[model samples]
Target chain A: MKLTRYNPSTLTDFDSWFRQPFVGFPSAAQVFSDSGSNRLAADIQEDKDNYFAQFEVPGVKKEDLKVELNNQILTISAEKKQTAGDTEQTYSLSRAISVPDGVQGDAISAKLENGILTVTLPKAEHRKPKTIEIA
Target chain B: MTTNCCNPSPTQQTAEPEAAVMKPRYFVDGTQEAYEVRVELPGVPKEGVSINLEENVLTLRAKRTPSALSDWKTLHRELKGLDFLLRLRLNTQVDEEKMTAALDHGILTLKLPVKEAAKPRRIEVQ
Candidate 1:
């Protein structure tokens, strides 16, 4: 199945549609205006087994990146000090993702290249069915 | 690109220092199958959002309905200003009819499915 892009501003059926409730009214300033250089983009890849998350977090040091796991949920957060862009201003961006059940937490790993941060979460073994004799 | 239909034009609102103003951020990504565009517009409710396609241009505009609820004693104003704009141009191969948008969690995602003629296909043996 293909997932369509979500545009909140252009939604015509918001009143008639039922959702899980928004995590506060997210605004452009809340996400983009924070202390430190912000995460410019994120790429989430999910297959039959596991999910991989990659983020473009430039000008951030390796130690600044933080990852937390709680009850099958994973939240990746980071903070970068202000650079040339806004020396007088500070900004931060945080994203939390819920991991599916039966996945190993310690096996997750992250790597930074240039300014991109990539995290790979391996899926737990999937169960397959087998037939048994009726005798 | 400014069409003066609304009471307070967003572009002008962003220029003023009355309240908190926002800046538009564009996300452009390419995968093996297609390219995705994610533009972030926060604070504005879904009712005030509009996306239009004319010629090769794709325009996005979202604003906030200035609220009347104000607490004089408890208010610490951080500039909750309105007016946001996101605009783009599509290539000739993009399928305009299949374009989709959803406002989830606060992120505006636009999924422009590629035309069948533009996708890569493999020929099988007869």
Candidate 2:
């Protein structure tokens, strides 16, 4: 069976419809698409409370990294500089993720511990349930 | 005719298993004292990391330990549960004896000291 690579930026229903011919599982497709955005491989997971995204960023010091959020869009960018054989080489990777409507962008917090950068965006409000009384 | 027998193409090394997703991105920064090698290995803990240098070749391998939380379903799992492997051919200037490595935050940083002969030397003339 062929595996389809997943791109997280896809939120439209038509995107899933187009992917119907390729991968049967969504999680497997997401794993296969790690090669799309340069050397940055990140995972987004959901639980009862919040959504967490952990990105792989090695050799990037804290000062060279930047995280910005605007209107539910989170952008992670980092600049990697190295001096190889007396010649300076630089490379930068940036990824912008579109958060769902329920996420609280203002309450988002990020921390860099051990080389992985973890960004947590809490769910703003839970869906309210409605009930109709039977007479 | 020039013979390029010293460098071996990465594909020639067949000891790696088929399951491995080889050739991870790496950065080599050369300084006056030593060369720093950085490899991104997310989700790997400190215990399973290994770095070995032998016969002019440097090999890096890390095995992923299954987390005890099997009851949870994996959604959008990317970096976890995948083993890491990369075999890099090193130059002769690398001082194998003094090499050091550490794993933090899923990134492995290795310091390879340059041999004395390979370092730049200043000569005085009368």
Q: Which window of 10 residues has the lowest lDDT sum in candidate 1 chain B?
A: B1-10
> Model 2's CAPRI class?
acceptable
Compared with the true structure, what per-residue lDDT tens digits does model 2 show for residues A61-109?
Answer: 7898899986555768888775555577788876656566677778899
A28-112 in candidate 1: lDDT tens per residue? 2354433425433344554444456656454456787787776555556777554221243445656554455556688888876
TM-score, every prediction: 0.38, 0.62
Candidate 1, residues B83-122, lDDT tens digits: the string is 6665565553557788788764235667666678966679
Regions of candidate 2 where Cα sits further than 4 Å from its true position: A1-40, A125-135, B1-21, B28-36, B64-81, B91-95, B102-107, B114-126
Most accurate candidate by DockQ: 2
TM-score of chain A of each: 0.58, 0.65
